[model samples]
Target: MNFRRLFAVMLKEMRQMRRDRITLAMIVGIPVMQLVLFGYAINLNLRGLSAGIADQAGTAGARALVMDMVATGVIAPTQTVNTPQELMASLRRGEISVGVVIPPDFERRRIDGREAVQVLVDGSDTVVQSAAVQLAQMPLDNSVALANATGAREVTARQIAVVSFYNPERRSAVNIVPGLIGVILTMTMVLFTGVSIVRERERGNMELLIATPVSRSELMIGKVLPYVGIGLVQTTLVLLLGLWLFKVPVRGSVLDVYVAALLLIVANLTLGLMISTKAQSQFQAMQMSFFVFLPSILLSGFMFPFAGMPRVIQWLAEVLPLTHFLRLIRGVMLRGAGLPELWPDVAALIAFTAVMMTLAISRFRKRLD
Candidate 1:
């Protein structure tokens, strides 16, 4: 073996790695972080759903029925409205997932040998809604038992019904694919952009480019555009695979998905640029990108339902760009929601891109200060 040459190469490699310590740490840290975070974070099962009650009966028996429903632990009644219209309005506002209404004749119907009760659910979230509806069925089951006990003719009461709005099929793919678009785009954009910039810096060529008349903003834009193209390609690949292989239906306009992809691609590239700006070496940039990505996949409602997470974790998820991106794509693709419906997500993505790009530029312009 050429020991001298090998030693020289080894020394140079060590120097490069040492300068890019953050990348090294990210490389070591991200995999472990993902393993731990995903293990703990992705929970498909739901608990503690926010429910609304419309108790027009306002009687002791009616209150008792609502209490029985609450005891199931799958749902918690957050408010009581006086009418069904109020409950529906609350659902539109996302104040509650399930709405239960007990008519004024609730108690009288039981006494008069009749049955009347109903449950309304948004059903946008299949897993959680089903769990809420299962709990809401408690009152009807109780009525059945009471009627059997009273020796009355079995009354097949049909007033109680379960309504599922957005994804009535409860298709897992429908719920998952919208969020996956964001996750994959973010990961690909960040990885490619972050690592590519670091490679340029590490190769000692970045100084030459900086010495040129190319302004920092122009240089940054130049560095980001190629990765943006790559991200769009990846987005297209994923969408095609998802549609053809997974057979997940595309319910919304194709333009919506494309628009969402473009925004997310830019945001993720900005995030990657931010990581690269913070990192002195290519490997370090990769590490930070992976670290950011793990929590994104786990907490961004991609693999798990956000409602199932603890309140603190949900709050944590709110800061992540992927969280908002997922909401936008899911709303468009699954619910056929329009810009008015997904405006918050678009606004959040825009803000995140602006902030991340500013940070990245500021850091990149700082001369090792």
Candidate 2:
């Protein structure tokens, strides 16, 4: 309660705090880092989504409609494909989120006050779908009304057919549940595996393993095989629960889902092995695991729409294994997407796993040194 003593103790604590540079930097730096990251990364404005237009009309009104869509700032005109098939192909490749197919008679109809345009949106993204629908409709009503007002005779207004494929209802669970599988796997698989080799080193067992004849690659694989099976079981349980509890539809082959799941698990596990090598103790391993886990959660499109983020943040999110896996799982579970449709994500996971395994094996040494 003494003021003098309180000041003395405060000064002493301040000195000690200054000496603990890591903790001091963490206190000031971590908050600033997160604030900058979250501030710039979080965006609700779904603007400039890549779009392809199939303007069969090739006329003035049809061109006006496409320009109006771009003016809405929802769908950016990225490609001008000649056929609906080409537009759909771009959608399937995930190249474009919005596809506008102007019918052959679109301009004639708009002139005659009976315009009908087909707008196909990739509904895999709930937020983008909603935004696209809103912006798409905003311009549509004006165009429709204008068509009616400008017509020679009393005629019907333009009609925009907004079709949201993959998730027509815009149900959140249909999008989140599949991504949850990746999130859960990333959390558990990374933390548990992160501690695995570190615990051995801390407990004086790594020395014995080093004395044995096993090579590093062999040792790494041996450690990972058991976790692979565990990963499969965990994936199955989480997926079943999602299906039962959320009625989350599995649109693609169940086998394909698990196949991708297995590959994703291996990728995460390999990254954990790399973390385990640098961590000197179990606590350090856990800290490192979370350091990796935190980014995967926020930036992986697990919680928010990926396209809603700035382009740079989207590229950073691409670095995380969870991002690709979430894409693959969501595509398979919600869109019935096959391997051909999802090969890029599959390839990303494969490349990531290979790189992490190489790093872990290189860093791993059996000796305490």
> CA lDDT of 57 in candidate 1?
87
Model 2 C-alpha lDDT per residue in residues 216-297, reported as the tens digit of each score: 9999988888888888998899888988998888988899899988988999999999988887778768767767876788
Each model's TM-score, in the order given? 0.77, 0.88
lDDT of 1 by residue, 1-369 (tens): 999999999999988877766756765776777775667666667877888898988876567666667777777889888899888766654557788888888856766655456777766667776786675345445545555676643334344556676667777776777677787888778887787667776777777776788877777778788877777787788788888876766666778878888888998888888888777677567667767887888888777778788787888888888888777676666656654556777888899999988887777762422
CA RMSD of each candidate after superposition:
4.7, 3.6
Output the number of the TM-score-best candidate.
2
- In the predicted model 1, the residue pairs found to clash are 22-284, 23-283, 23-284, 26-287
- Tell me how far the alpha carbon of residue 21 in candidate 2 is from the true structure, in angstroms, after superposition: 7.6
- Weakest lDDT window of 10 consecutive positions for candidate 1: 152-161
What is the lDDT, from 0 to 100, of the residue 34 in candidate 1? Answer: 72
TM-score attained by model 2: 0.88
